[model samples]
Target: MRWAACAAGVGLALVPMTGSAQAQEELEEVQEARRTLLMAMPGTPVSSIWGLVGQLGIGVEHAVGSYVALVGSVQVSGALQGTESLLPGGSGSSGQTWGVGVDPGVHFYLTGRAPEGLWVGPHLELATYHWTVQNEYLMGRPDVPLSEGDLVTVETRSRTVQYGGSVRVGYTAILAPGLTFQVGAGLTALSSRNTNFGTPRVEGGGAATDVEGQQLLGSGFGPNNIRNWSVSPRMTLGVGWAF
Candidate 1:
Protein backbone atom coordinates (compact mmCIF):
# COMPACT_ATOMS: atom_id res chain seq x y z
CA MET A 1 0.00 0.00 0.00
CA ARG A 2 2.96 2.36 0.70
CA TRP A 3 4.37 1.60 -2.77
CA ALA A 4 0.88 2.24 -4.24
CA ALA A 5 0.73 5.64 -2.48
CA CYS A 6 4.21 6.59 -3.79
CA ALA A 7 3.18 5.80 -7.36
CA ALA A 8 -0.06 7.85 -6.97
CA GLY A 9 1.94 10.83 -5.74
CA VAL A 10 4.33 10.57 -8.69
CA GLY A 11 1.43 10.43 -11.13
CA LEU A 12 -0.20 13.44 -9.48
CA ALA A 13 3.02 15.46 -9.93
CA LEU A 14 3.21 14.45 -13.58
CA VAL A 15 -0.23 15.99 -14.20
CA PRO A 16 0.96 19.55 -13.45
CA MET A 17 4.22 18.92 -15.41
CA THR A 18 2.27 17.99 -18.54
CA GLY A 19 -0.05 20.99 -18.09
CA SER A 20 2.94 23.33 -17.65
CA ALA A 21 4.59 22.05 -20.80
CA GLN A 22 1.40 22.61 -22.80
CA ALA A 23 1.04 26.12 -21.37
CA GLN A 24 4.60 27.05 -22.32
CA GLU A 25 4.06 25.92 -25.88
CA GLU A 26 0.84 27.94 -26.08
CA LEU A 27 2.69 31.03 -24.89
CA GLU A 28 5.34 30.64 -27.57
CA GLU A 29 2.72 30.44 -30.29
CA VAL A 30 1.09 33.60 -29.01
CA GLN A 31 4.39 35.48 -29.05
CA GLU A 32 5.09 34.40 -32.60
CA ALA A 33 1.65 35.51 -33.73
CA ARG A 34 2.21 38.91 -32.19
CA ARG A 35 5.54 39.27 -33.92
CA THR A 36 4.04 38.36 -37.27
CA LEU A 37 1.23 40.88 -36.83
CA LEU A 38 3.53 43.72 -35.81
CA MET A 39 6.05 43.05 -38.54
CA ALA A 40 4.18 41.64 -41.50
CA MET A 41 7.19 42.18 -43.75
CA PRO A 42 10.85 42.58 -43.00
CA GLY A 43 12.71 45.88 -43.15
CA THR A 44 14.63 46.67 -46.33
CA PRO A 45 17.36 49.14 -47.42
CA VAL A 46 17.16 50.84 -50.81
CA SER A 47 19.35 52.89 -53.19
CA SER A 48 18.53 54.68 -56.38
CA ILE A 49 20.58 54.85 -59.58
CA TRP A 50 18.76 57.92 -60.94
CA GLY A 51 16.81 60.31 -58.79
CA LEU A 52 14.13 62.96 -59.06
CA VAL A 53 15.33 66.07 -60.91
CA GLY A 54 18.54 64.39 -62.10
CA GLN A 55 20.13 63.29 -58.88
CA LEU A 56 21.44 60.00 -57.43
CA GLY A 57 20.12 58.85 -54.07
CA ILE A 58 20.12 56.11 -51.43
CA GLY A 59 17.59 55.31 -48.71
CA VAL A 60 16.39 52.88 -46.03
CA GLU A 61 13.08 51.73 -44.61
CA HIS A 62 12.04 50.38 -41.19
CA ALA A 63 8.90 48.44 -40.63
CA VAL A 64 6.71 49.56 -37.73
CA GLY A 65 3.64 47.59 -38.64
CA SER A 66 2.18 45.33 -41.28
CA TYR A 67 1.18 48.36 -43.30
CA VAL A 68 3.48 51.20 -42.22
CA ALA A 69 7.17 52.04 -42.39
CA LEU A 70 9.59 54.97 -42.03
CA VAL A 71 11.78 56.00 -44.97
CA GLY A 72 14.74 58.35 -45.47
CA SER A 73 17.11 59.14 -48.36
CA VAL A 74 19.91 61.48 -49.47
CA GLN A 75 20.85 62.69 -52.96
CA VAL A 76 23.94 64.22 -54.59
CA SER A 77 24.74 65.82 -57.97
CA GLY A 78 27.68 67.46 -59.81
CA ALA A 79 30.12 64.85 -58.64
CA LEU A 80 32.07 65.43 -61.84
CA GLN A 81 33.35 68.85 -60.81
CA GLY A 82 34.95 71.32 -63.23
CA THR A 83 32.74 70.11 -66.03
CA GLU A 84 32.40 72.29 -69.13
CA SER A 85 30.17 75.25 -68.50
CA LEU A 86 26.90 75.77 -70.30
CA LEU A 87 28.36 79.06 -71.51
CA PRO A 88 29.23 79.52 -75.19
CA GLY A 89 32.35 77.79 -76.43
CA GLY A 90 35.71 79.59 -76.01
CA SER A 91 34.69 81.53 -72.93
CA GLY A 92 38.32 81.27 -71.71
CA SER A 93 37.03 80.42 -68.22
CA SER A 94 35.29 77.20 -67.20
CA GLY A 95 32.29 76.76 -64.90
CA GLN A 96 31.11 74.06 -62.49
CA THR A 97 28.68 73.61 -59.58
CA TRP A 98 27.70 70.87 -57.11
CA GLY A 99 24.60 70.17 -55.02
CA VAL A 100 23.40 67.90 -52.21
CA GLY A 101 19.94 67.11 -50.94
CA VAL A 102 18.03 64.99 -48.41
CA ASP A 103 14.60 63.44 -48.24
CA PRO A 104 12.70 61.97 -45.24
CA GLY A 105 9.22 60.58 -45.00
CA VAL A 106 6.88 57.74 -44.08
CA HIS A 107 5.54 54.98 -46.29
CA PHE A 108 2.37 52.90 -46.37
CA TYR A 109 2.42 49.58 -48.16
CA LEU A 110 -0.83 48.30 -49.62
CA THR A 111 0.08 44.75 -50.53
CA GLY A 112 2.37 43.96 -47.59
CA ARG A 113 3.37 45.65 -44.37
CA ALA A 114 6.92 46.35 -45.60
CA PRO A 115 8.84 48.39 -48.17
CA GLU A 116 7.43 46.24 -50.96
CA GLY A 117 4.34 46.49 -53.19
CA LEU A 118 2.49 49.72 -54.00
CA TRP A 119 3.53 52.28 -51.42
CA VAL A 120 2.64 55.95 -50.96
CA GLY A 121 4.36 58.40 -48.69
CA PRO A 122 5.05 62.06 -47.86
CA HIS A 123 8.62 63.37 -48.03
CA LEU A 124 10.56 66.57 -47.41
CA GLU A 125 13.64 67.71 -49.36
CA LEU A 126 16.37 70.32 -48.75
CA ALA A 127 19.23 71.25 -51.11
CA THR A 128 22.02 73.79 -51.72
CA TYR A 129 24.05 74.89 -54.80
CA HIS A 130 27.50 76.40 -55.56
CA TRP A 131 28.59 77.66 -59.01
CA THR A 132 31.59 79.49 -60.53
CA VAL A 133 32.53 80.96 -63.93
CA GLN A 134 35.86 82.30 -65.25
CA ASN A 135 36.74 84.06 -68.51
CA GLU A 136 39.72 85.85 -70.23
CA TYR A 137 39.49 88.34 -73.07
CA LEU A 138 41.98 90.48 -75.08
CA MET A 139 39.38 92.69 -76.85
CA GLY A 140 41.11 92.32 -80.26
CA ARG A 141 38.18 90.65 -82.14
CA PRO A 142 34.51 90.04 -81.45
CA ASP A 143 35.09 86.30 -81.86
CA VAL A 144 38.27 84.24 -81.24
CA PRO A 145 39.87 87.36 -79.83
CA LEU A 146 41.15 85.74 -76.64
CA SER A 147 44.00 83.42 -77.54
CA GLU A 148 45.35 80.66 -75.31
CA GLY A 149 48.11 83.04 -74.15
CA ASP A 150 46.27 86.07 -72.80
CA LEU A 151 48.09 88.13 -70.15
CA VAL A 152 45.04 89.69 -68.49
CA THR A 153 42.07 87.47 -67.58
CA VAL A 154 38.76 88.04 -65.78
CA GLU A 155 37.46 85.52 -63.18
CA THR A 156 33.91 85.59 -61.84
CA ARG A 157 32.60 83.39 -59.04
CA SER A 158 28.99 83.15 -57.90
CA ARG A 159 27.31 81.02 -55.25
CA THR A 160 23.62 80.50 -54.68
CA VAL A 161 22.41 78.49 -51.67
CA GLN A 162 18.80 77.34 -51.72
CA TYR A 163 16.67 75.58 -49.10
CA GLY A 164 13.40 74.03 -50.04
CA GLY A 165 10.65 71.75 -48.72
CA SER A 166 8.15 69.62 -50.61
CA VAL A 167 5.16 67.36 -50.27
CA ARG A 168 5.74 64.12 -52.18
CA VAL A 169 3.62 61.10 -53.12
CA GLY A 170 4.93 57.99 -54.84
CA TYR A 171 4.26 54.40 -55.74
CA THR A 172 6.93 51.71 -55.65
CA ALA A 173 6.40 48.48 -57.54
CA ILE A 174 8.63 45.46 -57.10
CA LEU A 175 10.22 44.29 -60.33
CA ALA A 176 12.06 41.36 -58.78
CA PRO A 177 13.26 40.28 -55.39
CA GLY A 178 15.20 43.21 -53.93
CA LEU A 179 14.58 45.39 -57.01
CA THR A 180 11.97 48.09 -57.46
CA PHE A 181 10.78 50.84 -59.82
CA GLN A 182 9.45 54.09 -58.44
CA VAL A 183 7.81 57.15 -60.00
CA GLY A 184 6.72 60.15 -58.04
CA ALA A 185 6.32 63.93 -57.92
CA GLY A 186 6.61 66.71 -55.41
CA LEU A 187 5.38 70.29 -55.02
CA THR A 188 8.33 72.35 -53.92
CA ALA A 189 8.90 75.89 -52.66
CA LEU A 190 12.38 77.36 -52.42
CA SER A 191 14.10 80.40 -50.91
CA SER A 192 17.55 81.38 -52.18
CA ARG A 193 20.43 83.85 -51.70
CA ASN A 194 23.15 84.60 -54.24
CA THR A 195 26.59 86.27 -53.96
CA ASN A 196 28.96 87.21 -56.77
CA PHE A 197 32.62 88.28 -57.13
CA GLY A 198 34.89 89.21 -60.04
CA THR A 199 38.58 89.98 -60.58
CA PRO A 200 39.68 91.67 -63.81
CA ARG A 201 43.19 92.61 -64.93
CA VAL A 202 43.57 96.27 -66.07
CA GLU A 203 46.38 97.17 -68.42
CA GLY A 204 47.17 99.91 -70.98
CA GLY A 205 44.90 102.88 -71.92
CA GLY A 206 44.21 103.58 -68.22
CA ALA A 207 41.31 101.10 -68.20
CA ALA A 208 39.23 101.36 -65.01
CA THR A 209 38.56 97.94 -63.46
CA ASP A 210 34.86 97.59 -62.43
CA VAL A 211 35.23 95.12 -59.58
CA GLU A 212 31.61 95.04 -58.33
CA GLY A 213 30.24 95.89 -61.74
CA GLN A 214 31.96 92.94 -63.38
CA GLN A 215 30.56 90.60 -60.74
CA LEU A 216 26.95 91.60 -61.46
CA LEU A 217 27.35 90.82 -65.15
CA GLY A 218 25.87 87.35 -65.43
CA SER A 219 26.50 85.31 -68.60
CA GLY A 220 22.97 83.82 -68.30
CA PHE A 221 24.35 80.36 -67.57
CA GLY A 222 23.97 80.17 -63.77
CA PRO A 223 21.65 81.23 -61.01
CA ASN A 224 21.54 85.07 -61.05
CA ASN A 225 18.89 85.66 -58.40
CA ILE A 226 19.60 87.29 -55.04
CA ARG A 227 17.26 87.01 -52.03
CA ASN A 228 14.37 85.56 -54.01
CA TRP A 229 11.82 82.77 -53.55
CA SER A 230 9.79 80.67 -55.96
CA VAL A 231 7.50 77.66 -56.20
CA SER A 232 8.00 74.85 -58.71
CA PRO A 233 7.34 71.23 -59.57
CA ARG A 234 9.65 68.27 -58.92
CA MET A 235 9.46 64.94 -60.68
CA THR A 236 11.22 61.57 -60.33
CA LEU A 237 11.76 58.32 -62.25
CA GLY A 238 14.29 55.83 -60.95
CA VAL A 239 15.25 52.20 -60.36
CA GLY A 240 16.18 51.08 -56.87
CA TRP A 241 17.25 48.03 -54.88
CA ALA A 242 15.80 46.99 -51.55
CA PHE A 243 17.36 44.43 -49.24
Candidate 2:
Protein backbone atom coordinates (compact mmCIF):
# COMPACT_ATOMS: atom_id res chain seq x y z
CA MET A 1 0.00 0.00 0.00
CA ARG A 2 2.76 2.44 0.87
CA TRP A 3 4.53 1.52 -2.36
CA ALA A 4 1.32 2.36 -4.24
CA ALA A 5 1.28 5.84 -2.70
CA CYS A 6 4.90 6.40 -3.67
CA ALA A 7 4.16 5.29 -7.23
CA ALA A 8 1.22 7.73 -7.42
CA GLY A 9 3.46 10.57 -6.24
CA VAL A 10 6.08 9.67 -8.81
CA GLY A 11 3.42 9.55 -11.56
CA LEU A 12 2.20 13.05 -10.58
CA ALA A 13 5.75 14.34 -10.78
CA LEU A 14 6.03 12.90 -14.31
CA VAL A 15 2.70 14.49 -15.39
CA PRO A 16 4.55 17.82 -15.71
CA MET A 17 7.77 16.11 -16.92
CA THR A 18 8.74 14.31 -20.11
CA GLY A 19 10.35 11.03 -18.94
CA SER A 20 7.84 8.24 -18.15
CA ALA A 21 10.79 5.87 -17.98
CA GLN A 22 12.33 7.70 -15.02
CA ALA A 23 9.03 7.74 -13.05
CA GLN A 24 8.58 3.99 -13.59
CA GLU A 25 12.16 3.33 -12.38
CA GLU A 26 11.46 5.17 -9.06
CA LEU A 27 8.24 3.19 -8.60
CA GLU A 28 10.11 -0.07 -9.11
CA GLU A 29 12.58 0.86 -6.35
CA VAL A 30 9.74 1.59 -3.92
CA GLN A 31 8.07 -1.72 -4.77
CA GLU A 32 11.28 -3.62 -4.16
CA ALA A 33 11.66 -1.97 -0.70
CA ARG A 34 8.09 -2.85 0.20
CA ARG A 35 8.46 -6.48 -0.91
CA THR A 36 11.63 -6.92 1.19
CA LEU A 37 10.01 -5.33 4.23
CA LEU A 38 6.95 -7.57 3.96
CA MET A 39 9.06 -10.73 3.58
CA ALA A 40 10.94 -10.22 6.85
CA MET A 41 10.09 -12.91 9.41
CA PRO A 42 10.62 -13.11 13.12
CA GLY A 43 14.28 -13.99 13.88
CA THR A 44 13.83 -15.07 17.52
CA PRO A 45 14.28 -18.79 18.27
CA VAL A 46 11.72 -19.99 20.84
CA SER A 47 13.36 -21.46 23.91
CA SER A 48 12.48 -22.35 27.53
CA ILE A 49 15.83 -23.08 29.12
CA TRP A 50 15.50 -23.91 32.85
CA GLY A 51 12.13 -22.25 32.84
CA LEU A 52 12.82 -18.52 32.64
CA VAL A 53 9.77 -17.79 34.77
CA GLY A 54 9.40 -18.55 38.49
CA GLN A 55 6.70 -20.92 39.81
CA LEU A 56 5.41 -22.38 43.06
CA GLY A 57 4.52 -26.04 43.58
CA ILE A 58 3.72 -28.21 46.57
CA GLY A 59 3.87 -31.99 46.78
CA VAL A 60 1.15 -33.57 48.88
CA GLU A 61 1.80 -37.02 50.37
CA HIS A 62 4.76 -37.28 48.00
CA ALA A 63 8.33 -38.52 48.33
CA VAL A 64 10.83 -35.78 49.11
CA GLY A 65 14.61 -35.83 49.27
CA SER A 66 17.85 -34.02 48.59
CA TYR A 67 19.36 -34.68 45.21
CA VAL A 68 22.83 -33.64 46.31
CA ALA A 69 24.34 -33.69 49.78
CA LEU A 70 24.46 -30.32 51.44
CA VAL A 71 28.19 -30.01 50.91
CA GLY A 72 29.71 -27.24 53.02
CA SER A 73 33.07 -25.84 54.08
CA VAL A 74 33.80 -23.47 56.92
CA GLN A 75 36.70 -21.22 58.00
CA VAL A 76 38.34 -20.58 61.41
CA SER A 77 39.23 -16.94 61.76
CA GLY A 78 38.70 -16.19 65.44
CA ALA A 79 40.12 -18.98 67.64
CA LEU A 80 41.58 -21.46 65.13
CA GLN A 81 43.05 -19.62 62.14
CA GLY A 82 43.38 -21.80 59.03
CA THR A 83 41.85 -21.19 55.63
CA GLU A 84 41.83 -24.93 54.92
CA SER A 85 43.47 -28.16 56.01
CA LEU A 86 46.59 -29.23 54.17
CA LEU A 87 45.97 -32.29 52.07
CA PRO A 88 47.29 -35.24 54.09
CA GLY A 89 51.07 -35.00 54.15
CA GLY A 90 51.00 -31.23 53.84
CA SER A 91 50.08 -31.43 50.16
CA GLY A 92 47.28 -28.92 50.69
CA SER A 93 44.88 -27.84 53.39
CA SER A 94 41.33 -26.58 53.50
CA GLY A 95 39.12 -25.39 56.32
CA GLN A 96 36.27 -27.84 55.71
CA THR A 97 34.69 -30.17 53.14
CA TRP A 98 31.37 -32.06 52.78
CA GLY A 99 30.38 -35.28 51.09
CA VAL A 100 27.19 -36.86 49.80
CA GLY A 101 24.80 -38.79 52.00
CA VAL A 102 23.23 -42.06 50.89
CA ASP A 103 20.00 -41.89 52.85
CA PRO A 104 16.80 -42.07 50.78
CA GLY A 105 13.95 -40.67 52.84
CA VAL A 106 10.44 -39.31 52.29
CA HIS A 107 8.15 -36.81 53.90
CA PHE A 108 4.53 -35.64 53.75
CA TYR A 109 3.16 -32.22 52.92
CA LEU A 110 1.38 -30.43 55.72
CA THR A 111 -0.14 -27.62 53.72
CA GLY A 112 -3.73 -29.00 53.59
CA ARG A 113 -4.33 -27.54 50.15
CA ALA A 114 -1.73 -26.29 47.63
CA PRO A 115 0.10 -24.79 50.58
CA GLU A 116 1.01 -21.80 48.44
CA GLY A 117 3.28 -23.94 46.31
CA LEU A 118 5.11 -25.31 49.32
CA TRP A 119 5.27 -28.68 51.11
CA VAL A 120 5.22 -27.47 54.65
CA GLY A 121 5.62 -30.79 56.43
CA PRO A 122 8.22 -32.98 58.08
CA HIS A 123 11.12 -34.95 56.50
CA LEU A 124 12.51 -38.13 58.00
CA GLU A 125 15.93 -38.95 56.61
CA LEU A 126 17.53 -42.30 57.37
CA ALA A 127 21.19 -41.44 57.83
CA THR A 128 23.61 -38.76 56.79
CA TYR A 129 26.66 -40.17 55.01
CA HIS A 130 29.61 -37.97 54.14
CA TRP A 131 32.70 -38.22 51.96
CA THR A 132 36.10 -39.00 53.34
CA VAL A 133 39.47 -37.30 52.85
CA GLN A 134 42.37 -39.08 54.44
CA ASN A 135 46.10 -39.45 53.89
CA GLU A 136 49.05 -40.91 55.82
CA TYR A 137 52.51 -39.57 56.51
CA LEU A 138 55.65 -40.67 58.36
CA MET A 139 57.13 -38.84 61.29
CA GLY A 140 60.70 -37.56 61.91
CA ARG A 141 62.48 -38.41 58.62
CA PRO A 142 61.65 -41.01 55.99
CA ASP A 143 65.32 -41.50 55.08
CA VAL A 144 66.60 -41.70 58.64
CA PRO A 145 66.33 -45.10 60.36
CA LEU A 146 63.48 -45.32 62.89
CA SER A 147 62.80 -41.85 61.50
CA GLU A 148 60.15 -41.53 58.86
CA GLY A 149 59.39 -38.20 57.13
CA ASP A 150 57.84 -37.44 60.53
CA LEU A 151 54.86 -36.86 58.29
CA VAL A 152 51.29 -37.31 59.50
CA THR A 153 48.29 -37.36 57.23
CA VAL A 154 44.71 -36.42 58.07
CA GLU A 155 41.60 -38.53 57.64
CA THR A 156 38.20 -36.88 57.53
CA ARG A 157 34.90 -38.70 57.17
CA SER A 158 31.45 -38.79 58.73
CA ARG A 159 28.19 -40.81 58.75
CA THR A 160 25.17 -40.41 60.97
CA VAL A 161 21.90 -42.30 61.43
CA GLN A 162 19.50 -39.60 62.43
CA TYR A 163 16.00 -38.43 61.58
CA GLY A 164 15.11 -34.80 60.96
CA GLY A 165 12.34 -32.65 59.54
CA SER A 166 11.97 -29.24 57.98
CA VAL A 167 9.29 -27.06 56.49
CA ARG A 168 9.83 -26.88 52.72
CA VAL A 169 8.40 -24.24 50.34
CA GLY A 170 8.95 -24.42 46.64
CA TYR A 171 7.46 -22.74 43.58
CA THR A 172 6.41 -24.54 40.42
CA ALA A 173 5.76 -23.03 36.99
CA ILE A 174 3.70 -24.72 34.33
CA LEU A 175 5.94 -24.61 31.30
CA ALA A 176 3.65 -26.62 29.07
CA PRO A 177 0.25 -28.10 30.04
CA GLY A 178 1.08 -30.98 32.35
CA LEU A 179 4.84 -30.41 32.37
CA THR A 180 6.05 -28.12 35.13
CA PHE A 181 9.39 -26.65 36.22
CA GLN A 182 10.08 -25.89 39.87
CA VAL A 183 12.65 -24.39 42.22
CA GLY A 184 12.55 -24.41 46.00
CA ALA A 185 14.48 -22.80 48.85
CA GLY A 186 13.98 -23.71 52.49
CA LEU A 187 15.58 -24.24 55.94
CA THR A 188 15.88 -27.50 57.86
CA ALA A 189 15.50 -27.72 61.61
CA LEU A 190 17.20 -31.03 62.06
CA SER A 191 16.87 -32.99 65.29
CA SER A 192 20.22 -34.64 64.77
CA ARG A 193 23.11 -32.29 64.09
CA ASN A 194 24.99 -33.19 60.93
CA THR A 195 28.66 -32.42 60.52
CA ASN A 196 29.76 -30.50 57.43
CA PHE A 197 33.40 -30.73 58.58
CA GLY A 198 35.24 -32.81 61.11
CA THR A 199 38.37 -32.47 63.19
CA PRO A 200 41.63 -33.21 61.45
CA ARG A 201 43.11 -36.64 62.24
CA VAL A 202 46.88 -36.48 62.31
CA GLU A 203 48.73 -39.80 62.45
CA GLY A 204 52.32 -41.07 62.15
CA GLY A 205 55.32 -39.51 63.83
CA GLY A 206 58.99 -40.27 64.49
CA ALA A 207 60.09 -43.01 66.94
CA ALA A 208 60.18 -40.30 69.56
CA THR A 209 56.69 -38.94 68.89
CA ASP A 210 53.80 -40.63 67.07
CA VAL A 211 50.95 -38.33 66.13
CA GLU A 212 47.70 -40.22 66.62
CA GLY A 213 44.20 -39.21 65.48
CA GLN A 214 43.67 -37.72 68.92
CA GLN A 215 46.57 -35.31 68.44
CA LEU A 216 45.12 -33.93 65.23
CA LEU A 217 41.60 -33.77 66.65
CA GLY A 218 41.20 -30.05 67.02
CA SER A 219 38.46 -28.23 68.91
CA GLY A 220 35.98 -28.54 66.07
CA PHE A 221 36.57 -31.57 63.88
CA GLY A 222 36.71 -34.77 65.89
CA PRO A 223 36.52 -38.51 65.41
CA ASN A 224 33.05 -39.88 64.59
CA ASN A 225 30.66 -37.05 65.42
CA ILE A 226 27.24 -35.60 64.59
CA ARG A 227 26.64 -31.95 63.68
CA ASN A 228 23.69 -29.67 64.24
CA TRP A 229 22.08 -26.16 64.08
CA SER A 230 23.52 -25.92 60.57
CA VAL A 231 21.80 -23.43 58.27
CA SER A 232 21.64 -25.00 54.82
CA PRO A 233 20.58 -22.69 51.97
CA ARG A 234 19.11 -25.09 49.42
CA MET A 235 18.00 -24.76 45.78
CA THR A 236 15.87 -27.24 43.85
CA LEU A 237 15.41 -27.70 40.07
CA GLY A 238 13.46 -30.45 38.43
CA VAL A 239 10.53 -31.24 36.12
CA GLY A 240 7.22 -32.42 37.55
CA TRP A 241 4.20 -34.10 36.03
CA ALA A 242 1.09 -32.52 37.51
CA PHE A 243 -1.97 -34.73 37.39
Write down the lDDT of every candidate, Cα atoms only.
Answer: 0.54, 0.38
The 10-residue segment of model 1 with minimum total lDDT is 36-45
Best model per lDDT: 1
Candidate 1 C-alpha lDDT tens digits along 128-172: 655554444433323434342223345556655667676666666
**Candidate achieving the largest TM-score:** 1
For model 2, the superposed segments whose C-alpha errors exceed 4 Å read 1-122, 125-127, 135-148, 154-156, 193-227, 230-235, 240-243
Poorly placed runs, candidate 1 (over 4 Å): 1-54, 79-91, 110-112, 140-151, 197-225
Q: Across residues 1-243, which tens digit of lDDT does each residue of candidate 2 receive? A: 999999999989977675677788885554333210001111111111111212232232222222211111111111111333344444333322222222122323333223113343333333332345555544444457433245656666544333454444555443323454544556554445445455555655544455343454554354454544444544444554533
Model 1 RMSD vs true structure: 9.9
* lDDT (Cα) of model 1: 0.54
